[model samples]
Target: MRRGIGLAAVLVIGCGGGSEPGGIVPLSEEPAYAVVLSDYTSTAIAMVRADGTAVDERWVTSGTETPGLVAALSGDVAIPSAGLGDGTLWLLDRFRTDVLTRIEVPSGEVLGQVRTHDAGEGESGWSSNPHDVALIADDLAWISRFEPNLDPAAPELERGNDLYAIDPSTMTRRGMRIGLSQYDVEVAGADGTSATAFARPSSIVRLGDVLVVGLARLTVAFDGAGPGAIAEVTIATGETRLIELEGLHDCARVVPAGERAIVGCAGFGDMAGKRATAGIAVVELVDGHVEITRTLRFGDDEQLPVASQGVVHVDADRVLAFEWGAFDPATPDRLFEIDLATGSAVEIASSAGPFELGSPLFDGAEDLALVPDASRGLRRFVRGEDGTWSEMDAIELATDLALPVRHIARL
Candidate 1:
């Protein structure tokens, strides 16, 4: 049986007509929508029109004992379709907990939840660290687990570093598993313990019948990473192939860009080494084969200084990305409008401090982009009549929790 909690219904006026008790509520009558925001520990959702107007900030909140949506300890909001609208949402309660909670939008109801991994002895015994989900249909979905089990006697379902097929509606596994252990590399820990590094699958994006998964390939001790790779899994047959990027490490974010996909690779190692290996890879499916057509490397004199914390494709030739500035305290993180064709970038906005910005969400219909910042709230950027993007005033949540915005998904 599925586990869930019941919460009081909160009415949202003016967006659409009211629904009967326990019925599906229409979020909006138009294409205008809302975004669900997470702060690792909790979440808050808000509605915004196509014109960039904030409709409601407290449509749903994690302020009560049994909140409609919850992120246990350290977790994130996982929506199958980040750029597109989907009424379904998944909460990944990672860290010490290996649970995946399914939520219904508008109603803010917890439909059901499932433990993604097996529990051993104590609290820190084991965790699969479920990262991202790719929904193929109403009953079919795939979740990528980031941590690999070191125990040689672990069960197949308990093994991490792979994708597990599940039914989204029931929040249960469908008895099929796609393992990526073939991509593991050897590494040593700080205690000098040598073990095979995990593929550490993070983000997943669906392209036709194939699912493109990004592998972080971090060491056993989590202190370093190897050359990142992309695993292409055939949805119908469960066949898989790994494509390793020569210089990139920790390529964990993948976004759809027209016929191609943009991968954000945060390189590994010390400060200088991280910058040298960090870059972006533009990939596309050609003749049934996944190929990396272009790459934009950081650390070069002309390239961007650091790796990207978030990236969103604006068009076929351009992408909006924010740099990771934690390596250097003197440099604040900046959002850039990068030109893929020319290998050039234009600074559009900057954060107050390092590591404040999170993955961005863009609505082409609204021509609006949202970047979540820990200190600045939710930042908005709008494209003007002259085709130039400009920053607008940030949207502040009315909640008193003081949680930083970590992840966002369009409603």
Candidate 2:
């Protein structure tokens, strides 16, 4: 029950300062052992085993599109294969997860790769639906293209998104509009009609050269609710800005704790009275802009109504959001346990949501946390030292057995 929506400041980009702590292994394949599921529609790419054990029934990178999200980088595993569904961005092999190599991102090059709506690169008007993939440096890589582009004549409205800068030593793709779908801008002031031109990029996080993206907007009038923003790109100088949030709207995951920014909103559920922005958005980046500070909701609108999905961060103040209830297993999916210093939040752990596919992956050893829960297939929680969180054994992947998942990484 807290919705600030403040900050339009702008002025803090002296040079950029906050992205320099690396530890996902980087190259000898230590992304926490292994657990990369993205059977978006199914084609293979399961690989469980860090304790969850599924042992590769078919890690087939991609051959029929639909791989969705995954980017564990180091010795491999960069799968973004959502070419809107035609799929293609796989880089696999993060320690024998099957061989796949493709990052030649070409079709329209970049404008959001508009092939035809979701594959937008040929006949369709807008598509840039890339969604998730990041490395920051170590050869450089970052991908996220899912924004604005709504125009069904007037379905609330949205028309923006595109941010790619992958070199992978030279796989290619340099298209950054910063955050990409700012539309006309002027949130809070409502000057731009009332807001809601939307800005939908979903997840991305980096602090040093700036980067910080995680958005999902809708505010002005739709009843279903919408409001979530944080787009601060400056990777070498794409120089963009936008920080407007309120409880958050659709974001899904934007990890990175020390410098702040742990959004995982998805709200938009129980709209009886209509005010669903969902929860969590603690952002940062002061002086120049970007400041949501804190939002974490669900104190009891009835509880168990969030939408979050796969977030990490676990230290600096804790984080582990993941509650993908949309597939509705009765619509409760848990695993919250936030604490950004003091904003509080509990739930501890619980997922088997029935379908949208639970999502959280950390397990760098010690504190542990890795779930893929499709009825409890690859779960594992273990925190305790003083902090708390339990529930360990889970491993039943026959290639997602029943299927329907669509994202989960940490190889």
Candidate 3:
């Protein structure tokens, strides 16, 4: 699914007032703020206040060096960590350009940019295809490289399928690289030949000192997927342990839900058969041990559909999830509010077209949620006083860039 964009440097476009051209200006002081929108090939940002007023739709626009405020991102898959709460955002230009771009959300300053993969001279270079990043400290962070390096002679640090520690301040590799090759499992291929299930680490979340990472565990050829697994890495000691979920497959998205964490497993197969194995796993972090508390299968006498993505926690007992509409083109993608306690789902919204809904971004402070719709721009949903969600005005994207709205993140 990798494709090249040929981005080489950071790009900035000034849209807000009080700044020079190609520079970013800080939005007005508010307790809550903006949303960064990306359509894969290009990007645009909207600065919105806590009261739902948009300060600027074109807060940042396309430029010569970069797509927008950050490097061009991959829309092949929606990245979970679109924005970080610490006044910063780390944008991953995966697929072709394995670059990670960091930006200060408040100031719109490009703090640092680095290519995560080793680009050796000529034919020797390989792309690591970074997926998600988790900030460990002011100077420390961990990023998951999704693709495995097939070359046995590759350097241990350059070898994919592991979490690499980096200095968030410098955007450079730091400390020891945490290898995940040991978690790989062997499985039967479609032709009855045995294949290696590479531990394709994707989404990661930091829970205190333990980092919970989701493993896709797909075959090297990317044609088949094995059971999903979660790796818990100790922050201080760098110790790692793999917890395999027996029936879950292609489980790649992880999100923190209050004191617990939820893992969304998109089981492999065609739409009809995939739902039988697809589900969500509820995990709990007790003391320092990671444990699976419950597993909710999507199609087992439930309303939840297969291929759940963009899982967002809505307190300890509830979460907002998106269901892919690939089973039928006429079936629009849906946004569901799931009750973890009851294993029930309520369809909150549906896209206008199949597979048009991207990741959903929730702002707890404002009791608001933003769902990126390719056909309708950014759809806003507000929580009522009685604790119910209702659709509000869609955020206007008044830019000339004709890219479809696919992903959104908060500033």
Candidate 4:
């Protein structure tokens, strides 16, 4: 049975919609579209009003609630149990602020039931980790699964080649594995600890006619991943081509800029266990093959970064990316805008560390990008009239409403 709370039916509980302003939808209004928060440490999926304040502590679900990742489909949210290895997809209605359906994914958890927050602990059996869900249409989608038992010392554990086609209506795998190509990565040991590890997939993007996938298999615990590969998947035929990249680790943030895919790559120093600088891989797909047209590296002066996430395409050539190094107070995170034509990357904004950087969300008009900083609050980057991206005012999240949100899952 599907479980959900109706939005319009909550007026009596003071949880109903709020008043209007300027004949415009008030920021206080029962969230025209609420911001869903998945705090893994807190073990809950909470919500903040549309204005980025106003916390609803009770608006959470029960279970072994580790909010790994989420995808916004139209107005609904798709949250998979990547961290939990649960074979379920929680489909929540953003407007109603409730889960309307629970769809299963390939190799989903055997505990097939709607889970509650206070549910007792149980021995959920072994299963493949469901990494991400990419919807191609209303009832069809592609889900990437991770192979289990990734041994850090064993370099062979880094090879990941799992992608599946599924029908949402039935929660079933539609065909055989859409094979992923393997890339060899060499990891070096810094001290007694071996840096060698397995390469795994990180992010996925859809280009003009192909789906771009990021694979970084050799990831040593906490030290970060080894050199990665970006694969181009044909949507119509489910055919995939694995294009290996050099000096590139995790391209968590990949965006489509016109004819090419702007991939933010971390350099070789990451494999040595030190916080290293990052580079940009400017790639274009031709005849279903991945080609690296050019690679842009930061000068020696810009050496305090590792990898990037929440990469967004601003205009025709300008793309925004957030850089991550170590995340301590001494190490500040960076935001950059890359010029595709010149391969020039300019630092746009920097944030004090000890805080987590949430995924980036762009306004419907694509004029503004919003990222939540768990330690401070929320930060906004706007597309300037001059074609450059400029920092806008950032508001701190209400410390009392919810725990420092790990990531603002969806806007």
- On TM-score, the leading prediction is 3
The full ranking of all candidates by lDDT, starting with the best, is 3, 1, 2, 4
User: What lDDT score goes with residue 299 in model 1?
Assistant: 66
lDDT of 2 by residue, 127-197 (tens): 44555656665345666655445555522212335555554443444433344654334444234344443
lDDT of 1 by residue, 1-411 (tens): 233444344423222112233443445533244455566655555556664455655454444223332333233545443443456546565656667766565454567666676565532466787888887877787889888877777877777789977776666667777888988987766566776778888888777778889888888677767677888998989899988888878888887877778888888878787788888889899888688999888866445656466778887777888876765546678888888778788887888888788777777777788887788777899987776888888877544556566656655
TM-score of each: 0.85, 0.30, 0.86, 0.64
Name the 10 consecutive residues with the lowest summed lDDT in model 3: 1-10
Model 2 clash tally, residue pairs: 15
Give per-residue CA lDDT, model 4, range 77-100, as digits (tens): 334311112234444332222212
lDDT against the true structure, per candidate, is 0.70, 0.49, 0.72, 0.47
Report the CA-based lDDT of candidate 2 relative to the real structure. 0.49
Report the error of model 3 at residue 339, Å. Answer: 1.3
- Tell me how far the alpha carbon of residue 191 in candidate 4 is from the true structure, in angstroms, after superposition: 6.6
lDDT (tens digit, per residue) of candidate 3 on 1-411: 111222335544323322345556655553244455566655555666655457666555444233233453343333336345767656676776787766566666666666776677531556788898887777787889998888878877788899987777667667458899998888887787999989999988777779899999999777777777899999899899989887778888887776788898888877765787788888888778798998887767545655368888877677888887754447788898888678888889998868788777777877888887888877889888887899998765654566566766554
Cα displacement (angstroms), candidate 4, residue 253, comes to 3.6
Candidate 1 lDDT for residue 132: 81
